[model samples]
Target: MLIMKPRILNGMMICGTESEMRYCDIGELHKDFHLGTNTTIDFIMDQYDSGFLLELCRRTAQIVYKDIYQQLQQGNSAVLIEHLQYYLDREGGVFDIKTVQDEISVNVSKCPMLSHITSNGETLSPNIGDFLSDFYGSWGENTPFIISVDYTYPEESYCIYIRRYYAS
Candidate 1:
């Protein structure tokens, strides 16, 4: 049995064995997904308050953190920074990660979601910062690490500093 891997090539998602390959137009899918996500976010903001959105982001972060934690426990061998780098690279985000001593800094020059949202002529929610704060805050819960984020929505740029905490 041949193992099939999915890859992106020339704006197409290619998958399946070499004998028979399947191709999907990544451009169409990307546009549709971004539009749907932007619309959903707008609808959610219109229907609920910012606090509600923050809570949702927090919960999502907790879930993701738990999964990463579990993977680490199973001897995945990848560090948190590596996981973050993988996510950003896969999501089409332009970012740089640097580690110094016990601290890691992630600088995102182009936030894919935010860029897509703004490109669609949609206004960002005023509570975007609060949402991000809650998300990263919750993500570090129950861990010996913490993350701080500073972002400019208009420029779609952000800097995240991740530091290890020690209980002395």
Candidate 2:
């Protein structure tokens, strides 16, 4: 007889072998956090104005992208793109990335976060675009790149364009 114990290794949860093995990542944690954060923002919006929510979103973006900002400062742009792809994949996002000249475009057909929240009978913040804009904008600040996000909320899709910039 063999007894298998569940353990966490390299950010994945390992329980058994083959089919019994389960993979886990921070995506789920992020989903929960996003839900809570959105809910809090919604509650606050009732008492405050849109500026407060935008500022909160901007601050959240700053905190979340702080490490990525450091990496960009260290000249690790490839790693940043790779990390973004990996993150979207892990979160079950439907997206495609294309590179043209000095620009890279990421087209997200389906947003995993929105899907998760809606599936749970929750509504996403109407100002979600502001958060995304501030998030990528903050990450690109003082870096050698320009990041922009274009959203089509009715279809729940968006495209992020990252262009490298060089000082002349």
Candidate 3:
């Protein structure tokens, strides 16, 4: 049997992979984080009082991005979780990706995402729901998070990828 690729998969281009790409849409995304109440960016700019929300969103994005980037570099699940937790525990109004790398370093663990979910949650099942739940619980109502990881092997047995999207 032969398999084809999807139009979009994990922020990558898969012309001839083992199978089609899969995408999972997480609703509401960062709405709980309170990016905006009812007004749009135009209104915020006109009012000249949207700095707070904007700052929060920017910081949130930076934190999430840096965390994931570092996690990937470490290549270890436990270290990734610990590193993220450390960042979350820190006190900083502005989010800076460079700062995260400076503070701590841990051994790289394969599949850092799984490690993150495992440490945050007591039990982790193969089900994606379990991972989502763990993420939601860890980030809390104020923290916004998004992730996208692609693993493909056209010549291998199969391809596996995970993606996370964040919005406020």
Top-TM-score candidate index:
2
TM-score of each: 0.68, 0.70, 0.19
Global lDDT of each candidate: 0.63, 0.67, 0.32
Candidate that would win on lDDT = 2
Per-residue lDDT for 23-127 in model 1, tens only? 222222354465565565566688987677777766676564566554433433135555566556657899998878777788988877777778878776555
In the range 6-122, model 3's lDDT, one tens digit per residue, is 344576643342422122222223422222222333344456544544454445433554454344434423333433434332311122222243122222123333334344442
Instruction: Report residue 143 deviation for candidate 1 (angstroms).
Output: 1.2
RMSD of 2: 7.2
Residue 57 CA displacement from its true place in model 1, Å: 1.5
RMSD of 3: 19.8
Candidate 2 or 1, higher TM-score? 2
- Tell me the tens digit of each residue's lDDT in model 2 across 1-168: 123456678767654422222222342345776687567666767888777766775565445555566666665556557656766777789999999988888898887766776777787787677667766766676778888899855346788888888889
**Lowest summed lDDT window (length 10), candidate 2:** 18-27
User: What is the Cα-based lDDT of residue 41 in candidate 3?
Assistant: 37
Instruction: Give the candidates in order of lDDT, highest first.
Output: 2, 1, 3
Of candidate 3, the 10-residue stretch with the lowest lDDT total is 153-162
